[model samples]
Target: MAISDFFCPQTTSIVAKRERRKEARPGELLNAALDLFVEKGFAATRVEEVAARAGVSKGTLFLYFPSKEELFKAVVRENISGRFKAWNDEFEAFEGNTCEMLCYCMNSWWERVGATKTSGITKLMMSEAKNFPELAAFYQHEVVLPGQSLIRRILQRGMDRGEFRPLDLDYAVYSVVAPMIFLMLSRHAVGACVPAHVELDPKKYIATQLSTILYGLRLSPGDMEPSQEIPQA
Candidate 1:
């Protein structure tokens, strides 16, 4: 019998099912690998363990990711890229005055950080980066630089519009963003050693910090009454 005539509908259906199973294999393996990497440090986590987590044989995991390093990089990239896109979208939607825009951006970023477990992962990566240059480079190139650049552009626009005081754009960007970064790093990465100096409310912290940078905390013109003249003693 010819090949077409010999193949029954049941045989064709079985082949189609096998093909779908094969196609789904890689994604399943990647997800399993990511979960393991996040739960266990990348250097300590073994490929065999990842395969076991995915319910695939060791050889099958290699077919999807050639090396453990590649798999770890993929996990970080996949986790953070969606977040960057969301931030960009929120920034683009900002239509308020410059002060309002600054406040909005800070609030949006804080909300995002609170929403994702990625912050914990980020803390892990930073602590481990000294040992893994490749992963560190990937994060710097893919995440940090792009975010800073976007912020710098916003600051530049605000400066041009006279909504913000004229200052070095890079310096301005750093001034606004550095505190938030430090707060996370100090609390999560380094571990706070000091006793509670202030309440740890993220919203209030962000508002107070941003206001200090954007508008000095010193009493505004209307808030202070003119001082009565006094002769020097």
Candidate 2:
């Protein structure tokens, strides 16, 4: 037992409880911030609201995050960018054909991120990035670049194995990514307004997208024409 416990058991218990709460505050704050940021976009979410949701004072939040921008950075790193290394490692260790790998990649992303509140980050960025250029630049550097690089590596792997046809890596990566962007936008931005009759099943949508992309990418020796840049109007 602690010395305080010896002196007064109840006093020690309260102190221990406070210490535990202190330790948990940062995580609680991040969770609260994420929920609010998703529900009310970044500009509308005040630091005070985050602290209140976390059951702390506004001053206490500053003690940990210093600024709203800093808190947001921490939240993005905690929820999204931090996982890139493990994902990249998974790519490196994968033994399947590139088609299987791409399928796994898309489905895994839906499970891990696309179907979660974390997906709101992309919608949030699309809506507010113009006003917060610094944060936008930070996100581009931390999330966008790494994500594109990972996709490029996947496409390159297919090409190297001769399973995928030769294509411009820069443009082809976006071709692979565009469907996912549409999915994110649909879920976070436009889903509420979309009619229920035609609502998409994300799993089926991804399967169809994967089938389409893989068909386009599969090697067909002497049958495919080289891609040409579109002429400017």
Candidate 3:
């Protein structure tokens, strides 16, 4: 056998290429796991299936994630954690009129998540939190709280500037996001459960909801705009 053919066989290049791709394998595995978990859920998704989808063997999968639960945790950490960090960082740097900012943020929120695959996470959490308490807790601490905090900061800023009414910050925060949360759940959970509770065009619904919310939250009209004088004797 020629030395070149003996030492550097065809399979050798493929093996070397795969070895060079080791750094990306974990991310690939996590992405595959996310898709499967989103589709079949955590309880139903198998490690072997995730491995197959990721183009890795089960043994290789275990080398990175010892168990399915650990893999799921990695999925959460990789996806939600990074997204939340970037979102919070952007929110922190935002500067504008509170009403405009509120609308902008709400619209951005819906586009980024409410109508996307990420919305399924709300369903997953609700369904699986009882069984996966540790993962649920981590998700709450890392994702939910940060999200709530961002909402609270926006609402608090509006209130602080006399743009919105002074309201209970805690519950107000939740109320502000309640519609989006409900949409997320309803879309993923009971999207086609026979008779619908309410059919809506999301854009119109958001406009109406935000209008109502803004009306309620804004400073009283008398305080906002000067009252016209009554000239009648």
Best by TM-score: 2
Model 1, which residues run further than 4 Å from truth? Answer: 1-31, 82-86, 186-199, 216-233
TM-score (all chains, Cα) for each model: 0.70, 0.91, 0.82
Give the clashing pairs for model 2.
none
Ranking by TM-score: 2, 3, 1
Looking at candidate 3, the ten consecutive residues that score lowest on lDDT are 221-230
Residue 174, candidate 1: Cα error in Å is 2.6
Enumerate clash totals for all models, in the order shown: 0, 0, 0
Candidate 3: segments with Cα more than 4 A from true spot: 1-16, 190-199, 221-233
lDDT of 3 by residue, 43-161 (tens): 99999999999998999999999998888778877766668767767777888878888888788888987887767777788888999898899889878888888888889989888
TM-score of 2: 0.91
Which candidate ranks first by lDDT, i.e. highest?
A: 2
